[model samples]
Target: MPTPHRPSAPPAGRVDAIVLGTSAGGVEALTHLLPTLPHDFRPALLIVVHLPRHLPSLLVEVFSVRCRLPVHEAADKQPIQPGTVYFAPPNHHLLVDRDARGPSLALSADAPVHFSRPAIDVLFESAAAGYGKRLGGVILTGANADGALGLQAVKRRGGVTLVQEPSTARAPTMPQAALAAGEVDFVLPLEQMPAVLRAWGDGGAI
Candidate 1:
């Protein structure tokens, strides 16, 4: 794996899960980012992308073709598994919650935040509550400010926070908002993010 030239000291805890949020240019961005993660990458990945609630998402199919890791549309109560990538199903908010059996996925039809049912904020905030210091939150290319507060929540809970550098993003609004909100741990280009994530997946000592 490539060495991560992080902006700050990497989080000391093992990252149990990674939550990523993106909109506008998400497909293009993820197309580059997901393929770089090895098949054996250990942290579970959860993602949210803004889409029309009435339409079916082809994200799982499209990403599975490029990503080495297994990809699935997140299901309610599904157990979180290492090396798997879960995408929020259209119209539902995807959340992570710890139960007697460990961390599991939850789907909510609750009101949308920032006009999105599968809001990035909901997922990141829920994951922050569930994983605390063990979670890693990524805010990538998007046209909205949905993820800013959520990234802050992750940082407040002591989780690592990564924001795509606005200069390199197809849509800088989301990352810019996150940076403006403060407490972001890393501001990196798309290429570097996978390596940083891989290092964290490999137990964080790169």
Candidate 2:
């Protein structure tokens, strides 16, 4: 396992949104993290989890029951709302775009990255571009290296970056790859993530 870095405080502004990416044990990992978020937690959450292209995703249904905030499958041109969680639908690349109305969700069927549509890199990179310093990127447990470069992009854009501690991950490749690719603000066990995120949502320094 890589040495855990001390948590770095984000720049002097509240984060407006967070992008989370995962695969493999993602459902279990998210269960541990999202359910703990308070109902009034600020900041919108956008998520990408690798799923079979042929199958419809049930993430919205699953999480809506478990989470305090509203959960939905992301839709093209959907307006982003704070305190909500949006999951990328299977077979599309979820992206963030800003227009006159502010940041909104965009979906694309462009070629897959790392052999996965709704690739973590796609979502992270686009969210970094759309939200810039107001974005937060998190790479969780996964079987592939899909989120590494995306997390780097987030860092490059002056956004906060975090990874699930590889030592505690069910499939450590994604988190380990993210740590190897660039510096991260935090590397934490799943049990500790909710508190950190709650702090972020509360506009408190990490």
Candidate 3:
């Protein structure tokens, strides 16, 4: 796992990409957050929600209706398109490969980091490395510590980092872990996060 680095405020700006790792009580937070943005919002969304290793994830189907943009499972080596939401399904580890051209998803067999094949650190580190300062990471409600190290990576790379307030979270363990790690950029309740994310998504809040 990458070292923890947190900032009270991330430099004011819009991120080109947004990566979210969530579990436990994610549906409520995500449903609250996604529907607030316009259908054409530009930033790409990469999301991972830890699921039972053998079950098929229906998250994409469920979120697509709540989200304005098209939601789909990520395809390995497929180029990421703007204004779309991509999800990690079942047990595969989803990652991004960054080169001079840009970032694209890579499905990997690397052993689980933090005991999660779809580890939050894996996505955050790869995304931070791929998008650099233009990335954003959000770690929502979860029962475990999977995302703590990953959210730190996003902050270290100058990307925005946010945590759904533990008090507001249906499950507080993940948010509390993130808060203890460092002062995140936003410790807002789920209801208020969409505003910040929307403004950020559209190339800086106006």
Best model number under lDDT: 1
Task: Give lDDT tens digits, candidate 3, residues 1-206.
Answer: 96553554343446888999888888777888887878878889999888788887888888888878999899899888888898976688888887676788889877877677788878888898888779889989988888888888888887888898898888999889988887588888888887778767765443
Of candidates 2 and 1, the better by lDDT:
1
TM-score of 1: 0.93
* Candidate 2 TM-score over all chains jointly: 0.93
Stretches of model 1 off by over 4 angstroms after superposition: 1-13
For residues 1-206, what per-residue lDDT tens digits would candidate 1 score against the true structure?
97785656555436989999999999999999999999889999999999999999999999998989999999999999998999999999999989889999999999989999899999999999999999999999999999999999999998888999999999999999999998787899998898789877776665
Give Cα-based local distance difference scores for all models. Answer: 0.92, 0.91, 0.83
Q: TM-scores across all candidates?
A: 0.93, 0.93, 0.90
Sorted by lDDT (best first), the order is 1, 2, 3
Residue 30 lDDT (model 3): 82
Worst window of 10 by summed lDDT in candidate 2: 5-14
> Which pairs, if any, clash in model 1?
none
Angstrom error at residue 139, model 1: 0.6
Instruction: Quantify how close model 1 is to the true structure by its C-alpha RMSD in Å.
Output: 4.3
Off by over 4 Å in 2: 1-13
